[model samples]
Target chain A: MSARAETLPATGLRLPRLGLPSLDALGAWTLALIWIAPLVFAAWAAFHSPRDALAFDITAPWTLDNFAAAWVAAPWLRYFFNTMMLVTTILAGQLVLCTLAGYAFARFAFPGREVLFYLVLLQLFILPEVLIVENYVIVSRLGLFDTILGIGAPYMASAFGIFLLRQAFKQVPKELEEAARVEGCGWLGVLWRVYIPAAKPVYLAYALVSVATHWNNFLWPLVVTNSTTTRPLTVGLSLFAAPESGVNIAVISAATLMSIAPLLVAFLIFQRQFLQAFLRAGIR
Target chain B: MSDTDSLDRRRMALYGWMLLAPALILLTTFAFLPTVTTVWQSLFSRGTARRPAEFIGAENYQYLFDDPVFWQVATNNLIYAGVTIPVSIVIALGMALWANGHLPGRGFIRAAYFTPTMLPMIAAANLWLFFYTPSIGLIDRIAGLFGIGATNWLGQPETALWAIIIVTIWKEAGFFMIFYLAALQTIPPDLREAAVIEGASRWTYTRRIVLPLLMPTTLFVMINAMINSVKLIDHLFILTKGGPNNASKLLLYWIWETAFSYFDRPTAAALTVMVLAVLGLVAVFQFRGLEKRIHYR
Candidate 1:
């Protein structure tokens, strides 16, 4: 634990204290720059005219025309709305279903519980994307084709969510639940008051992960959605910049920026919190 | 008293079933049912307007086995997985080591490494599209500096999949880095102090102690990277669409095209079963072979 806090020593007990510290820092910085270069280039290209963008001119005049063109070229606002609804619907559904299922698996000693739990765990391997062909047929058969609900429905019952919530709930002290029961709370009441609150951090962590995941999800939505009204930002961006569309590189960059802006902005703003949330989620 | 206890047990069972019902229903509908149906469907001939579906046991499999495109796509997927998994894991480990050390602006470096993971693969693809575009693109421009003429990147079959592989490695390495970072933080500092007391070289200490400790993380990251190589085809949609005579085509993308684009459902189902089998094997290997050796604590 103490080692966890120690900022790894710069030049101690390693390599005879050669003046390699600066070189290491330089290497780290260079790698960081390389990692960020694409995004930096995207921003630059997105803000400049196509000619200037192609010319790689640092002195190019900045303009919003590319964004304007990108905005008018597609139904981006509708796509954004669809994505929001899709993620929200999936998140809400996952919360309810996973919470109930996780609680049962955590606390109840029912026959076949272990088998059922393992069955649910199997979903961790059988991702919805893997079953897209049949799922598409099922969705169309159920008349959910091209609908936001259809796009999100298949992912609503997340195995990862159930697993995470189960872990969180199991860690909760029994005394709290007993105390809630002593206050005349029923099972549901105790769950709502005690377990859920105790697992607030876990919920927050899962929510961030779930949102980021669905927001960036593309293939299933692309397959399910046929129109602008149903397509999410990722699918929309893909179609908008598709080679056949012949859209200029600048406009494509601008549209790419627009599509990723919300999550990207949120991520940049809440860098520490976002990273902490992911760490707490323990996805690996 | 025994009767009352039995009744209580029954009640608890009922409550548990009730709680599990919603998740089970959704999972069955989406995952379990689809898996079974995909396999079942693969054994039948695809239905057409003029001809109703018929039993065609192993026919679709026979066709897939004979299909050159299927072989090509499978080979491409193998190469994709083979390259992306090892490359990303290595780069991720490097990123983790850098970020975990006393580097200047570690937070910014870490964030920079991770930002690609947060972006949609579509957006990343779009950004890279311009970079890979020949003649007018960034790569060609950079190459021209060395008197090298334009080289078609995503246009050429030889370079297309490799280009896509690079983008995936960039996108994935940062994500795996976080896992390594988490694992790194757990190593006790006393070990480092003891190494120093023993006058061990940094390389020797890292190779002997740190690398060994990170083996579990490496395996964990490796499994995840393997799974991701199979699932992550989003960038392909924008980058190449498995183009250049299906040179860059992967199994999933090929399945999508066969089913949706060509309306060849049976073939797609057959391909999907292959995917499921691969994934099932991976799951078995992970759970049975590796799980025991993984040092969770």
Candidate 2:
């Protein structure tokens, strides 16, 4: 504000000058095409049959055969089940953990709270992937290896999630909580009646991010899981793609497409909401 | 002894621990436990089945110090981080500048640029490979039309890492640009107008007026870009696997091999601890820089 004042507009306008907006629009379209080309390619590859893929022809007939072949090539059904189970478990855990943690940070009177909170947030700086090698042993020791819970358990309470929810919880009016307290409500009652409902948008926002992130997750599941039976989509796709025996590009593309299809469909269906969710996620 | 008071106190204790439980458990198991174990494990030079393993106290790190592979891995990581971070930032800034400047159908453009960020590395798994496929592949096809040779991108050791760097830059630039775009919007338009009226050169306006104002955002974006690049590069599994004589082998991938392929779990742990330390050091540089520029925030 001060910087703008220092160069005071004296007696003139404040509006920034506009250039050729349409020219920019053209450039924008070109750049957007470059960015989306890979996605377009994957779509093209996934829909085309294997035989047509070899021919350098744009006029190849599209089919669901790749999807069908991809489906039969691996246990995509088991992969989906494991991935869904993993995501759901982790999201449910994070919501409960982050919400309560966020609430405690926002509402309570406690000693060394900020210190403890910062300690938890430190995990945000250090990713579990950096520690995956050691974590492999830890999981092995716990006998949790190859279990869906083992895969999902490690990321249940993200520091980012806690931080986001805490910010949202803090934004909820303290007066509302106090009013509930004054109306003969107990602390739990006040929290239930006031805090949770008020922070619903944040809850939804966190859920979308959690689901998207966990669905797309690879490294942790890669290290922990050894079999397709328990592996998520990323692991399944990687294992399916491992072509030390000369990879079939079309089939690999088919596997890749199948692996990410659910999320891709979800994104297209909820593009606007997904964009907002990502806008918030970028802050993380 | 009143029921209300007792229940209140009990509830308070319960909520506190309950709130703390999942995060603490997950963090302890995943972050803290592995870290601690990695440090312990690094102390042993636990060998292959050919040799019985025993306590070797810093020998793995000792080898890591002398072993040229570690240095190569370190160099590759630096190269990866170096190319991916700054190039992506520049591309992101340019995209944002163009998108922010005066774009009609900006929403369409913004969405278009951001489409890559939405793509899972897995979804675009073979996309880069195919794009880098010489002669007929997309990248070379464009280059070929201009009479450029089909460069041995991933095959040759010299250009292998650079090829990976290009893909990383492409994937990440759009993602980082969003943050810059967000930051750019926060800049008031009036300042630009005033600068324009002064007949400032485009470079002069950006350098004097826009750049200083964007210092904090730039710093934040740089830190994020650096951290993400260092930590979460599972794409290497598909693209290179630290390949062509470990030329593209990253620290994380090295740790991965140590644990899984070689079955040297202990050294893998130690290397992980090293990765954490290296990343922490990077964060320190970032934090100190941010302090100087954007202390208020």
Candidate 3:
């Protein structure tokens, strides 16, 4: 109010520019710093000796000892391999299944199509996590329990992916599909030749979202997998950093940061695509 | 020609069903069948070596109603949703506005806010575990600078849930911000200019012109947040294990504890049925609300 009054004293008309933009900037930066503080603190502790980490010694020399200790403390390499496999498997299955279903919904006129679409959409709310008990039993019955496939199976038929691809395919001009059909292409050939190419951006967006989701996923994997060979980074890290493990703070920090390093680096490198992908996915 | 066209139509319908088969199969096996099985299983009693499971209609749910831990966990989850959803959405709106505006280093600020979303929840909980560690933790160290004594943030019942709540908000608000930012970009700059031309203050322009346009995105983010509150409990495994007398325990976490840890599948199934009921309500609400949004568009 004081700033406004002072700025308006001459002509009694203060434009928005002279008001509190700078203060708003300050608030934004402050919140940003607070948002990033945990990561910064984790980096600080992970790079320093345990005593130095606890001491808040800004001048302390950074070392790799914590990383070394954390490395030896767990089978993170195997966990990483499991997570990569899990994410890729889910993406592969989702792409095939969603594209086929989405193409059907978009281009084909079939009895009960509306009912089937609504049924698929219902899966969006009745997610795998809520049905963990029965899913666990089902995986066990299929003899898939304790495997990566077991962890990935429930999520392979992604409702969001199907929905997004359906939207993408619907936007394709009828002329393109008709032209492909004129060339004597069957449904599969036309879908492969035209709709799939047109929906590449949607594929990337769905892939990014799916990989991030499954990579960070913990609960289902934690319940399904028993050994280090199948446990993803999240489950491994949880056990590694569990209070019962008695690991030190710096080492735990090192392990935690290492677990997220791959996804974090990919996100940083493709930051624009990541943001755009999420934006596109959300707006859908 | 009519006969051939009829043949083609039948063929097309057949191809469509074939195309949908794989997805429908997987969805039924995982989603639809599990839903029915969960409800059915909830009605039966937990089986044992000496006693085969028997149907005990409404007994498991009745037991859940009588269990104090169940009540506490349900209440904690409600508080979790009640606080995290609105608080994150409001912060997300502020973030979207600031990030979308002319703030310097806006890219870096936006990235900073979103980096956590890329992180695994367990990793996030591990990072917070350090700060919430008593005395030597960062929060206490900072408080120490102010001559304040140490406090156990996660070890006590009173602060444990609130501590968990803060992590949830920090982890979620940034993700929600992306939706708001997307919605914000779609708003025409001409509206703002016209408002300014009418002598509207910045606050007035934002309140009148900006917010109402973002309602659909708000509802979208709210549904996402609601689903997240139910599913995103990986941090609980790391931070509290719903510890210090079950203060921070959420329904899903308790369900996990019952089914896996205690091997009481019947009770867990009952709890899941309740969660399913809640999500069903959300689905109906969302579909209806989304239909209205589409109508508006």
Writing each residue's lDDT as its tens digit, candidate 3 over B1-297 gives 999999989998999999999999999999999999999999999999999999999999999999899889999999999999999999999999888876678889999989999999999999998899999999999999999999999999999999999999999999999999888888776676566468888778778878999888988999999999998898998889998999999989998899999999999999999999999999999989867768998
Q: lDDT value for candidate 1?
A: 0.89
lDDT of each: 0.89, 0.75, 0.91
Per-residue C-alpha lDDT of model 1 across residues A81-188, encoded as one tens digit per residue: 989999999999999999999999998889999878778877877878888899999999999999988998999889889989998999999999898889999878
B136-162 per-residue lDDT for model 2 (tens digits): 566776787899988767777897788
Is candidate 1 or 2 superior in lDDT?
Answer: 1
TM-score for all models, in order of appearance = 0.96, 0.88, 0.96
Q: Quote the lDDT for A278 in model 3.
A: 96
Pairwise TM-score winner, candidates 1 and 2: 1
* lDDT value for model 3: 0.91
Return the lDDT, model 1, position B202.
80
Docking class of 1: medium
Q: List the residue pairs that clash in candidate 3.
A: none
Clashing pairs in 2: B242-B249
Which 10-residue span in candidate 1 chain B carries the lowest summed lDDT?
Answer: B288-297
